[model samples]
Target: MGYVVPVRANISSINFHWQSLVRRPMPYEISFRWNDPEAMDEPRANVSYVGYVPRVESVFSVLFPCTGRVSAVVSVDIMLNITTYQPKQAIIFLKLKRSKTCLQGQPTPLNEAANDTVRLVLGGAEQDLSLVLGVTGAIGVTFVTLGGVMMFYVRQRKAALRYTALLSCWSLEPEQRPQPCDLLGWMQDLSASFDRLI
Candidate 1:
């Protein structure tokens, strides 16, 4: 039973054992009680890490030739989000009951239905705000420094090209040199590129 539903939380991986008992119509009530339940609100349905027990439904749906009860020890992996603010452990309570209704349309519990509890120990929060902030600041500084160095290198390259072009024009005979209009246009284009870099 490795199946699990996705949840929204900074949850580290966790592995635990769970059991399922099916007497009649299978339905169960599951509740998680934090050691300090008063501090936290009840988990909403959307964020609750709830999942179905795999293969239990299909196996239990069949009618048997002889009457008997079925029980199984299931391995379930549930991802629960723990925080620095919460307790280190929790108790999971389960109540197995019948989902079938009576003649009066009221649901009833099975006589042999049982309850179970599993102790879950959660590791402490592995990171804090300072670690995150430190990493972020280091990355920011690295990018800024790299950008500055790149800009300086580009400026140097452009200056070298400008100087080489001017020296080439000076070395050429006056009549062979570029037309003033062409030189002006080229200067304007270089200025435009410089402006873009700025």
Candidate 2:
């Protein structure tokens, strides 16, 4: 018969102790596995040992690999299998214990380098944006300059036309004076030009 044991601890190392009930040596097999939910197809850690037990008790320890320290309580399972010549032929005893290790400190060099790379990329993007804004500002200024020049040329042309109309009306001979309609048209043109200039 076998039994399942539930263990809860902040574990870093697992120690296993077992002994045979009989006074003589015996052959045994022990397996240890760590199950991870993220990887259902395969366990994260698997260890197996097959050897003969001496008359005295046997003790062994397995250190689980960890990238960093874990503070939270975790659950794990321990399984031990034994073979004997006959059923219930040998007495057996198993003991399991957990030990904790502390690893807390500042950021590692690799992490610092990664953070610096991210900052550099963001800085480069900001500089590129500034350059684009500078170009856009220059284009806007050029457009404003062209608009002012166009307005100046248009005003000058209108002023010249107004002066020429006034001179033509003055130089006409008394008998060659414009009809009432022609005079009215010239007056309307001069009034519009003055309005636009003001």
lDDT, candidate 1, at 90? 36
Error at 128, model 2, angstroms = 1.5
CA shift of 194, model 1, Å: 10
Per residue, candidate 1 scores C-alpha lDDT tens digits across 164-189 of 87788879999988788799887778
All models: lDDT? 0.38, 0.46
Best by TM-score: 2
**Model 1 vs. true fold: TM:** 0.33
lDDT of 2 by residue, 56-146 (tens): 4544554433333333222233334445533345534342322222233211122111110000000123445676799999999999999
Judged by whole-model lDDT over C-alpha atoms, candidate 1 comes out at 0.38
For every model shown, what is its TM-score relative to the native structure?
Answer: 0.33, 0.35
Give candidate 1 misplaced runs (Cα > 4 Å): 1-127, 179-182, 189-198
- Lowest-sum lDDT 10-residue window in model 2: 114-123
Cα lDDT of candidate 2 equals 0.46
